[model samples]
Target: MMQSQHPPSNYQNNQQNLDDFDEVWVPNPLGQTQGPAATSGLIDIIKSGSLDSLLTNPWLVSIFVATIISVLIGAIATILAGQRSTELTPEQEAQQALLQKSQNLEQTDNNFREYLTRDDNNSGMVSNPGLLQAATLEAGARYRNRIIASLNNPQNPAYNQHEELINYNSEIEALKRINLGASGKEAQLKYVDPSTGLWVTIPIDSAELAASGLTKLNIISNSRRETTQRFDLVTVAQNIRKILSEVKAARLEALRVKGLSPVASELEKTDWFGNKASPSEAEISDYQQYKPEPIPANPNTSKQTQDKPSPKPTGGQDDK
Candidate 1:
């Protein structure tokens, strides 16, 4: 062979072998010149791009605009939901007010009952059991007046109004009706006339009774007297028996010593003078408790109204 341009065997043994990769220039495989490769990631492209390039980039701009819009929509939804949760419906508001009104009415009623039964507060006042409606109305008025007085003062604490106070005037006027009785219901009384076999309505006054020549005890009525704060059946029975015994004794004394100074004094010396006619404590003195009898009324009556406004003592008067 001609003189070879290869290394000698001794030189090849001394030198290192060439690497698998080698740098070299060659013609393009497709016969076209190569251009610079895509040299940037998305972040690098955005940073290096001009404003015109950015404006023309629809995908990038669309993503940014969509993110902003989503955030704004979410914020508005959160605010609307918060407002909807905080607001009360009309029915719910009405129910809350009604509950408050009931509570106020109950409190007002309790206050009235407490004042009516307080012994020390009303020393000389006479509370009639037959006219409890009138008493309750009076008590309500007193309570309202007290509240009003405190409200007028600058030093008053926080106060809330009750339905009882608002309609107090109207309630009192209604309670003044003659037939409105102890139970706060219409309770008219009637009696059967023995001679004529006819039913008659109960008369109110002592004058009316005298004019009709009818004694209350003799005429059996169709109404029942309910027990009140002042009621004591035992005490009433005791008083009735005591008065009857005294009257009999006085009559005897009057007959025995007519126009004598010692007539009244003679009855004081008697053995049964001070006590009722019940058996002594040593004997079987326990008497069974008696409930008041119900006297039924016939529907027909003569007079529906009473001459008097109410039966007895009350706390206060009408509205301004």
Candidate 2:
């Protein structure tokens, strides 16, 4: 194999390469090795069409710069995307879970409200505030159960943690129950009957009801008799009715004593707890329509008027 005796001038710069030969390696696109051109050649490229032309052409320059910027931005975006994908730390995950749980709880609360609305729709008119409250509570229990069932189902949006939906603060839940008219732990509630102008007291056990979380609760009806917590609301209402009946009977007796015509035969009579506290429509109509007899003048007053007569015609002296 024959090797060159001296560096080929086309392949080397002997003058510049006085010391290191390592600096003269060149890059070629044709798959062949070459020598570095004179640095002057780069000046020519800058001054003429090679690099100068691209720099001079505004559109080409813009495209090139924009392409470089776009590539840089894309690379940065990819890195950011990767970082974001891995950014879910334990604390972040917990916060996200808590937010989702709160949303689920709020949704459950709305459902509970809807259930209360349904309870109000029932044919039974809960006339008394106590009755309305009790109904809300009964319906809240049913709503909670339904929420549990939905959460357990795979198709449910609140799936995987049904109980969390109902795990609200004790006081908050109690307030909701009361707002919805569920008798959640309230005691000594008073309601006034429209017919009778008297307030009826409702009783419940405070400590027991407060602890029951409004989900399940019972309280004494008697404020004084805390030991006897088993009185029924219906019974209380009945007693109120009886009291009202007595008041109506008293009113009827007054009318009877005044010699006023009775509105109804029943209106003139007292029937204790068995009777209604208010007059019937027919009785009310009769009372409005009937005319009472006028009171007779006192006989003694008329006799005195007669006895004091017989004054002589002395008008001038009387006037003086």
TM-score of each: 0.20, 0.22
| Model 2 Cα lDDT, one tens digit per residue, 68-93 | 99999999999999999989998787
Of the candidates shown, which would achieve the greatest TM-score relative to the real structure?
A: 2
Clashes of each: 0, 5
- Candidate 1 error regions (>4 Å): 1-202, 206-231, 255-320
